[model samples]
Target: MGTKTALITGANSGLGLATAKALAQRSFDLVLLCRSDQKGREAQADVQKANPAVTVDYFIADLADLDSVREAAGQITAKYPQLDVLINNAGYTPARLEFVDGIEKSFYASHIGHFVLTNHLLGSLKAAGAGANGPARVISLSSAAYLGGRAARFFRKIDDLSPTFAYCDDKLANLLFARELARQTAGQGVVSYSVHPGAVRTRFGADTPGFLGKVFSLAGPLMRTPEKGAQTSVFLASAPMKSIGERNNGGYFADSAPKNTHNRDINDEKAAWLWEKTMPFV
Candidate 1:
């Protein structure tokens, strides 16, 4: 059989990089997607140095831009006949409101971009699973913050520009997408999961200049390291199908275990609404 392949967004730093390295150690070929060419090259070198026997390549695509995402997906699909795992780990939480395709920046980058990219690569994922040793998986990095309230409270509309609301909305969307994906791809040999990597000492929300930034800064010492934060993602990507539990196909996981989400209202209606509303943007 061919070597397993995993594609990771935001692989240049933080949990994304840590997950890539862990997968490399497992002998999976990697495709690191970064927004910056310089950082992408640096991360590529780091992964290569850590695992010289595995193939490590980097591609540039800013997740905030749908066009960039499509271009990158095109390139990826053209080059790789199959994709074993896709870890949507990139996210954004700006201090002030930002817009992309008229949608909130955090929502666009964290959820919308990955939504489109995953659809574009679904064929590859299915092909991989069909020919691989086991089912292929898609792991999305959501946040425990999503449990604060119902996503509809913050994400009633796609145009909501509040930074905090947008961040929460996207995290909730991540879980919704994963759940819906699993539902749609059932019996297709592809499974999906949304993961909360725990509060990790990463650059998340550090760019924000206000109370949120200060909170992330103060919480730094108390949070998990990037390596520890990546454990759930690596587990979801590499663990046995039975080990992860068939019931977890569309579930949320943290610390390598299934965790309950706060949004009890996340049902087929909400997922379908989100998918339809965000279709034009993608």
Candidate 2:
């Protein structure tokens, strides 16, 4: 196979780092988009330490910040003509209410940034699809917390952004974005998938306050380790595109398997609606 490149956001730690390491093992040259130089460098060294043969590189980009995302995306596309995998795996639970251009910070971090970044990199992804790989994959990390966000509640009541509610909405948005992206790129040799990595014990919410923080502290044994949580994402990225496509070009997965979601709210209408609303932000 020709050189395969994968770009991952929020790759400093948690599921993102686990996924990066796993992909590195698969011989993928990595480009990790992180928010800090120190963290990015540390992650770069960590991945290289684990897989010396693979080329591991890192760039700084905050998922909630537009300029940073654009600059990183440009660098990625310029560096690689073929980007085989893109895992939109960075998610944050806002410690407090915040917004970027009126969009809730949590929502921006989870969905909008990925949205813009994906759109910007579509050229490279499609280029890879047209190569020997022939079906470039975009795997986005969403949560089953989407179950908490019903269609009726999404993208409404914009002003009062509750951290919890924002989390739910963004995950819902991730699923919807994956579906819509698959729809848009159906015949272009590009496929997108949304993943629920299960409840993994990671430092993502280590700073969360109150009951949620207590849950993180006390639920260590109950949650899967980051490596264990990364199985589905790794599976989706490495699986034969034909098999994956047969199941669903844009499917939701969990437990390392493609799942058929019964949530009525997870529909094309909602997906398109989200895609429409997201255009302006980018």
Candidate 3:
């Protein structure tokens, strides 16, 4: 049998790296996609050392830049020709608000880039096929922060992206994208799902506000380690979508279990809107 291929973005550290390690342990060949050249080199060495038998490849691309994402997708598709799994784990959170191509940073990196890359590489993922067993899978990393407690009540408007609000919007966007992707790719033998990897002790929360950032930082003692955090991502990668319910077809999971996705705006209409708006840039 041919070795299965798995590509993980931001695989240099934290949840992405941990997931890479787990996949390596499973003996799957790896394609580690990172924006940082130095970190990618270090991770290549580390993963190679740990899983000497598995072929590991590296590609560098900043997902926020559409050109970079397209280039990366073209290169990966040309080289690998067959891709079994795609984990969209790369993200950007700034201490101060930022934008890429005039859109919110979180929206650009978390949703737009991955959205385009998936489309660009859709053929390769299809080439891998479902076979008799199952199809290639795509795991998109969302965040629990989008659940917004009661604060979500005020999120009815798209213009409400004040400060941290954009992050929530983007995370919700992930769920919407996954759902539409499932519908679009149904029976094509390629599945896509979104996930909240639990609030692991990672650098993600460092840019958050006030006591929240500190509290998140201090969670090193209590929060799930990166390995534990990445289990659901791995599960989505390897598990059969049907067993997890229809929700798994285009829904959200947390900690390896199905969960109620948080937004009514995440309906088909909104997803189509996002897709149309993004088609030009992708």
Candidate 4:
């Protein structure tokens, strides 16, 4: 690849859009994925206008729909010989229990959907990693809410799911997915990391039900701006591998630093389990 490429999910707005701007500023060609085509093109133009030298492309894909994710990934891998960065940043919380292809809707949006996309693009990521600017990076956006994650094994059926609870559990799944990807791809020149982009006030959870939704809607004044929240993501996308440290592979990061947390649920065992449990879906 003449210039590095980054593929980001939910890139039409919020943290994803902000991250795309930052990466474009750093001269990376962007392949943005969004559910709405109009917003995707608008964001693409925003990034392209800001950094005229870089390429900004968009694909319309709903993470809730497995077929859509796969179709988008197919185009991406077909067009790009290698992908230098993959930001699994798309996330959403349904107001109540819902399903797409028999899986929980929020869980599908936050985890399984990205799972399929990443699986499809793994080849391109590995190709980039093994090349000159070796070790392609996979960055998943998680949240501190992961601490409250249920670890319910997302594939299982739950009679009811609160928006808040769904978010927490799915966030944990983000970390596990990253860790498992790192382990399976070890020594393959691809690295995975999960990030907690602190409570950036975005419309991401506008539809969240009840008290949590109220907090997200009213707490905008206290929350970090999208640009500020995207800093760690930009750092992870552009930093030297040595600076990130190889030991910290499959790490979780917040505030631009690796979080060596004591959370037992965020361990390799759980990561492996999640991988195995979700493999059939992919």
- Winner by lDDT: 4
TM-score list, all predictions: 0.94, 0.94, 0.89, 0.96
lDDT of 3 at 140: 87
Question: Cα deviation in Å at residue 135, candidate 4?
Answer: 0.7
Question: Model 2 residue 177 lDDT?
Answer: 95
Q: Residue 264, candidate 1: how far off, in angstroms? A: 3.4
Candidate that scores best on TM-score: 4
Q: How many clashing pairs does model 3 include? A: 1
Q: TM-score of the candidate numbered 1? A: 0.94
Ranking by TM-score: 4, 2, 1, 3
Superposed on all Cα atoms, the candidates' RMSDs to the truth, in angstroms, are: 2.1, 1.8, 3.2, 1.4
Residue 171 local lDDT, model 2: 85
lDDT (Cα atoms) of all candidates against the true structure: 0.85, 0.85, 0.78, 0.87
Pick out the ten consecutive residues of candidate 4 with the lowest summed lDDT: 152-161
lDDT by residue for model 3 over 1-282, one digit each (tens)? 226889999999999998998888877788999997898899988888768999888999988888998999999999977788999898665455566656667677788889898999888888887555358888888888666422232224334355455666677777777878888888897888889988787776677765556667787678888999999998887665566665467778897988886555767877677667667776
Clashing pairs for predicted structure model 1, backbone only: none
Candidates 2 and 4 compared by TM-score, better number:
4
lDDT of 4 by residue, 1-282 (tens): 127999998888899999999998888999999889888879989989768998888988998888888898899888987999999999887788887777778888889988888989999999999999889999999888888786764776676667787788889999899989999999998999999999898888887778779989998899999999999999999999888888988999999899975566877788898998877767
Per residue, candidate 2 scores C-alpha lDDT tens digits across 1-282 of 215788888888999999989988888889899999999999999988778988998988888888889998899889887899999999888777677776677887788899999999999999999988778999999988787665565545476556666777788889999999999998898998999999899888778665556777798889999999999998888877665656577889999778877677899899998899888867
lDDT of 3 at 153: 26
Residue 185 in model 3: lDDT: 89
lDDT of 2: 0.85
